[model samples]
Target: MSRRLVILRHARAEHGFAGPDHDRSLTESGRAQALEAGRRLALAGLVPDHVICSTATRTRQTLDGVLAELPARPSVEFEESAYAADLDTAFALINAADPDVGTLLLVGHNPTMADLASAFIDDPGLVSFPPASLAVVDLEVEWLYAAPGTGDGRILDGEGQVGKGEG
Candidate 1:
């Protein structure tokens, strides 16, 4: 069966925060961007059946915004490893997903998110995943066997518009 993977970058966050990077929260514009992303997902008919998200505060808050616009909530898992995972780690997370889930959404930080999305396409140099960007890749293989360069998948759609504010 064909599977769909949605790669989402966390929304714009406040800078100069006196906390760890993981503790940084989304800004007002970031929240609007997240909501727009959710609406876009629904409009594109790419609503996920399951989501694997980073445990970072911004990522969680981003997911919250996306979830708010979704008609139905999908199963979600918050994983700390996804915070700053490398491409391999990200792939492993995707590969470990339940085959029963046809669509999976992964929300995290970059350049891992950008790297992972680029790796799926034949030309890795052409893709860029900015803040609050969402990319939809179609994978022919099951999640268990998903790997870099093995996706045989192309980006169906991508949106990098996270509003005209600080990111």
Candidate 2:
């Protein structure tokens, strides 16, 4: 059976929050972007059956916004390791997903999110994941076999932004 992975970058966050980076919350526009991203995913019928999300405030908020527009209430896992995860760590998290899930959504910070999304495709240069941006990848293998270059992915919604005009 075919599987799908949706890699999402947390929405825009305030540069200057009183707390740590992990505690930073989404900006107003970021909330709008997150909502739009969810709508677009729903529109594209990319609703996930399982979600692996970062435990950070911003990522959780982004997840909340995205989940709001989706019809399915996916089983979610709040992982602290996903907060500032690397590509390997991201893969580990992904590989640990429920094998029965046909679609999986991962929400986290960038560099990792961007790198993970790009790693699934042949041409990494073609992807640019801005805040609230998402990449939908179709995989040929099970979640246990997921790895870089294992799937073909495309940027959905916008190149580096979501809900540009509406937000």
Candidate 3:
């Protein structure tokens, strides 16, 4: 069975302008971006059955912003290991996702989020996910076995768009 996954990088954050990255909270625009992105996902019928987010403050805050706008709240889980986590660690976490969930959303930090999306969707060069950007990919396989460039997944087009007063 195919598994649908949406990966979102945390929105722009403002933590006194200088501090720990993990502790950074979303700026006003970031919050707005998250809301807009969530609306886009809901409009596209991409609301996840289960939501997973990195344990970083920014990531969780991003999830919170999006979840706040959802009609039917899905189960949300957090994994600290995904904060600044590499691609390998990401795959392990993804593989461990519940098989019963047909759709899973992962909110995380970048380099890994971007890399993983590229790995699964085969469009690294074309699609670069900025902060608060969301990519919806459908993999024609089980979740656990999904690896970089290994599964049959394609990027759902027109998912990324610039926001008003985007940061």
Candidate 4:
């Protein structure tokens, strides 16, 4: 089977509306949105093999929200490198991923997430990543070779705030 990369932009943050960039936390609404996204992912049977998150407070909290909605714990890694990573840095992270991880869940901020998605999502009609959104990109290679701009992926399915069986 082909490996997959599931890119998730963290849910809305307090900084998005009320604080400085680096120290922001997830608002109550942001947590709920993140849980909603998680529930949707669970319902769709799209849980990843592992979950990697940025150490940024917003993404850390977002990972918690996602984990709260799942049946069991997914292995997690909090990477300092993921924070403020540009496209090339992000690409290196993705391309050096473990090959056995059939699916990798990356919870991070925008620009990086959007930039990575844009580089590979083959659908001309698929663009835009609202907060708490999930993008399941189907790939045809090992996880370690799935570079940002060189991936062969298509947007398989997309959803938000979906209840069980609703998507």
The digit string of per-residue lDDT tens for model 4 on 1-167 reads 67778778899887554555767888899999888877877876778888878898889888888888877677788888899888887767777777778778888888788777777765556556678767666676776667654555433244433221111
Worst 10 residues of 3 by lDDT: 158-167
The positional error of residue 68 in candidate 2, measured at the CA in angstroms, is: 0.7
State the number of backbone clashes in model 1.
0
**lDDT winner:** 2
For candidate 3, lDDT tens digit of each residue in 47-161? 7899889888888888988887777799988888888789889888888999998889988987888777777654435456688877666676688887775554444334444
Q: lDDT scores for all predictions? A: 0.82, 0.85, 0.76, 0.74
Count clashes in each candidate, considering only residues at least 3 apart in sequence or on different chains.
0, 0, 0, 0
Count clashing residue pairs in model 2: 0
Structure candidate 3, residue pairs in collision: none
Q: Root-mean-square deviation of each candidate, in angstroms?
A: 4.3, 3.8, 4.1, 4.0
Q: Which tens-of-lDDT digit does each residue in 62-144 have in candidate 2?
A: 99999999998999999999997989999999899888999999999889988887776556255467899788888878999
Residue 138, model 4: Cα distance from true site in angstroms: 1.5
Task: Give a tens-digit lDDT track for model 1, residues 28-100.
Answer: 9999988988887887777899999999999999999999988889999999999989988999999999989
RMSD to native, candidate 4: 4.0
Cα deviation in Å at residue 60, candidate 1?
A: 0.3
Instruction: State in Å the error of residue 78, model 4.
Output: 0.6
